[model samples]
Target: MKKNLFLTAIIIIVSIGTTKANSFKNNIYQEIKKDSARLSELDKFWTELSRTVREGDFEGYQAAYHPDAVLVIKQNRSISITEALDNWKQGFIDTKLGKKNDKVEFRLSKRIGSKTTAFETGIFYFTSTDSHGNPTEDYIHFEMLLVKRNEKWYALMENQKSEATKEEWKALE
Candidate 1:
């Protein structure tokens, strides 16, 4: 009787452990699914953004930002989306689109967080290709806060810096 009781108790303990393990596994799976969905949605926005910027589509690029967005530079000055976009559109026209040898690439270099909000770090590379196909690259590195509103991801704020030390980047973080 004692041996049988001990055996039964062991079975019960093992069952509980197994149940807990399964629960934890399930929770992880659910989290993965949730993050996967969030990534898909965010990727859609980033793809559109990259294409717009790369092609120097000023109107499309302008549309990507939320009207209420605020952009901040390393100098700590803040500006409205409209003003920023206006400045950028003019720059794009003069510098990027008209030059046949100029090719632009934009990429979301890093990101963190979830469905509603995220911190995105991106790089925009402008390359000048010679007729021989040798290319020179200039890059803009930027970080921004993005929010999903009305089922669309919009840039809510941006902070741009040039050539910061590693410690400064950590401080910014």
Candidate 2:
């Protein structure tokens, strides 16, 4: 009788342990699924941003940012996105008028965030035509802070770090 009681206790302990392990695994799986969904949404956001810049959609490009967004440059100066937009408006107008062409491409090195926010580090390649009609290209290192509001993503801050080499840009995924 004592032997049977001991055996039953061991089995119960083992069963409880197994159940706890399975519960933990399920939680981890759910978190992974949620993260994947968030990433997909972020990818869509970036794709739309690229399209706006390529098409010179000034309103659409501005819409990607929050009304109170901030722009930081090389740890030197900071300005409101509205101010930056004001400075950049002529470029958009020129592009829209076909007087100039512009294109931007981003390659991310790191992204960290939850469902509602993300901080991204990457390099951006910008190509444009100067007033003299000369083509110019630049690779800039940048960090972006984004937040999701009302199921839409918006840039909260854009930190343009410094210049990057083409090889450096190519190194990041």
Candidate 3:
């Protein structure tokens, strides 16, 4: 009878451990699934932003920013995104008219936030051609605060921090 009782206790302990392991795995899987969905949505946000730049869709570019958005330049000054956009409008027009071409690419160093908010740190490579077809390229480090509303992501604040070297840009994931 003692032997039988020992075997029963062992079985119960093993069963409890197995159950706990399965629960842990399920929790990990759920976390991964949630994070994957977040990344997918964020990718759509970046894709639309890049498309607007490449296609010279000024309105679409403006739409990517929240109405109350702010732009911080090199940690020195802050201004309304609307004012910044106005300054940039002529470049969009020039690109649309085929007088110039502009392109931007991002490489992230860090991205963190919840389902409705994100703070992204990245290096942006911006290239533009002059009317004479001469290309100018710059690598800039930037951080942006974004919020999702109604299933759409918009930039709430953009900080164009500083210039980065090509080596620095390539070091990020």
Candidate 4:
């Protein structure tokens, strides 16, 4: 009788342990699914922004950014909507003077964290026209820190315009 009771107790403990482990696994799976969904959504936004810039659709770019958007351009930084717009306009003028058009080719290098907050790094290739109407290209590595607020994701901070090589970008992967 004692042997049977001991065996039953061990079986009960093992069953409970298995149940808990399964529950934990299920929870982890759910979290992974949620993160994947969020990453897809973020990717969509990133693609749209890139398209807007490449097409020189300033309105579309403005719409994607928050009113209080902050942009860091080389050694200059803008911390307000008006300032950001002004900075863009200046850059646009310079690009036009060079007879160069802007194109952004971005490859998402990394995504870290969950839906509410994430760090994303990528490469941006800028193709434009020179003053002599010759084609020119530039490459920059960009990192954007994003935050979800009011059910929307906005870039809280960005580090961009750092010249990068293919090897450096590959290292990020």
Judge candidate 2 against the unseen true structure and give its global Cα lDDT, from 0 to 1.
0.92
Candidate 2 residue pairs that clash: none
Cα lDDT of model 4 by residue, 33-61, tens digit? 99988998798878887777666677776
TM-score for each candidate, following the candidate numbering: 0.75, 0.92, 0.94, 0.80
For each candidate, the alpha-carbon lDDT, in order, equals: 0.73, 0.92, 0.92, 0.74
Between the candidate structures 2 and 4, which one is better when assessed by TM-score?
A: 2
Clash pairs, model 1 backbone: none
Better of 1 and 4 by TM-score: 4
Candidate 2, residue 15: how far the Cα is off, in Å: 1.5
Candidate 2 lDDT, 1-173, residue by residue in tens: 99999999999999999999999999999999988998888888888888877778899999999999999998899999999999988888888888888889988888889999999899999999866789999999999999999999999999999999999988885
**Model 4 bad stretches (over 4 Å):** 74-81, 90-100, 130-132, 170-173
Summed backbone clashes in each candidate are 0, 0, 0, 6
Off by over 4 Å in 3: none
Misplaced by over 4 Å in model 2 are 130-133
Worst 10 residues of 4 by lDDT: 90-99
Tens digit per residue, CA lDDT, model 1, 4-84: 999999999999999999999999999899888888887787778766665667777787788899988665698998888
